[model samples]
Target: MTNPTLALTLGDVAGIGPEITAKALLAHPELREIARPVVIGDADAMRRGMRATGFDTDALVVIEDPREARNDPDTVELVQTGPSLADVPIGELSAAAGDGAYRFVVEACSLVRAGRADAIVTAPLNKAAMHAGGHDFAGHTELLAHEFGVKDYSLVLSAGDLYVFHLTTHVSLRRAIEDVTVERTTQVLNLAHGLARALGRPEERIAVAGLNPHAGENRLFGDEDADVLTPAIEAARERGIPVDGPIPADALFPAAMRRGRWNLLVACYHDQGHAPFKSVYGDDGVNITVGLPAVRVSVDHGTAFDIAGTGQANEASMVLSCVRAAELAPGWGAVVDALS
Candidate 1:
């Protein structure tokens, strides 16, 4: 089979997305061996990024189709998507930059749906800028879900063999607690298992972290773990999915990281998973949305406005996102089937 085609979306033009994309492609020479990356965004913004990041501008070649991409390590193939964003003011927010970011994703989704691309590896997009652009979505996961009309989705953060799936994200703590019902917990557990199976580890155990401290200390602190999370784990076990927990977050995360007890984990909310994962993995992790028709991977970090134009941003996560996208693209059909 030919190499998978990755539609790499350059997120918020004003932030570090463009700079990181340029840097990642240049920094990781092996990317050409795994996939053909076609950049989807404004050409002007990309040129500005190339110049700012000290990459040769002559390497950028704008093409109308993904099939036209040459997959050359020195060449950055771009499919210009939105309006010119070269003057959108790096290190600041602009409606034009926001709209351009939004448009790039839309175009990438269109490419995937049309079978022009096998997967998407996205750079960071500013949520505030996205809202300012009049497209109000929580983030890339939610936007991609909306574009694909998928409601049963979860934000999965992965670093190598470790995968953490969030039950609720981008919601207030109170709302998150309210939203952590048995149904949702079970859904996320199954999604986590689906991912494990997709990754060719169907027999690996899945761990569920508790919503309360010490997993509620057997009902001393809170009852969400006993009442909600436990039942979800039990039900998932009944379905013949190798599952464990309502384990305390503190113990579960440490064991997953150090001892290799479980490869798959279900986080109660965003920070429950994000904090420790980011702390340990840093630029090694990539965000994945399970239940989408096509594989979508993104840098776990956000658009860093403070270092936008300095060309000093680390492209590790961006490169990892692309690498993970290439790894997932081949078995993505199994992923789609398992999640659906």
Candidate 2:
């Protein structure tokens, strides 16, 4: 089988999305071997990114159709998904930049749904800018769910040996805890299990982190562990899912990282998982959305507005995002064979 077409979306013009994307494509020539990568964003912003990164190669080409891509290392194809952003200022959020980023994602998703692209790799987008531009969603996760009309989905972050799935994302800590019912936690666990399997893991162990310190210490702290977490874990196991805990938040992560005991950790809230995973992976992680209609992967880091136009951004995460997306494709093994 020929290489699958991987669609890339330029996140926010005011941030490091363009720079990192250009650098990733230029630095990793092997990307063209496994799939024809078609970039979806403003052409002008990409050009600026290419020049900023000193990637003076004819390998980059702009195409109108994803299928027309030739998978040539000498040509990274660009597909304009939004209007020209040549006048948009760098290092500063603007409605235009936010709209452009939103449109790019919408177009990329459309391609995947239409079967023109086999998978998607997204850069970072500024939430404030996205909201200012009239897109009222928390982040890419919500945007994707809304667009696809998917009722159930979860975010999984993979960094080297660590895998974390959040029980709640983009919400206040109080709201996060309130959202963690038995049903929601079980659903997240099931999604994590499916994602692990997709990534070649086989019914591996799962660890669920507690909502409170020391896992409620037998209700000395909170009833969430005893009342909510324990039942959820039991339900999962009863359904033939291998899982453990309501484990103490403080002890679970270190143990998982040190012993590799669990295939994935289900955190009760955002910071509970992200703080530990980011501490280990830093900026070298990929965020994957499970239960989507199409394979979608993104850099775990965000649009660093602080270093937007300075050419100081790292492309490692973005490159890994593309690699991860390729790995999750429907016929990824065949693509790997073609690469070999």
Model 1 lDDT vs. the true structure? 0.89
Against the unseen true structure, what C-alpha lDDT does each candidate score?
0.89, 0.82
User: What's the CA RMSD of model 2 in angstroms?
Assistant: 3.8
Q: Per-residue lDDT of 150-231 in model 2, one digit per residue for the tens?
A: 8677888887756788889988988998999988898887776665565567468889998999999999999999999999
- All candidates: TM-score: 0.97, 0.93
- Candidate topping lDDT: 1
Candidate 2 global TM-score: 0.93
Candidate 2 residue pairs in backbone clash: 59-74, 59-75
Candidate 1, residues 38-85, lDDT tens digits: the string is 999988888888888999899899999999888889988999896677
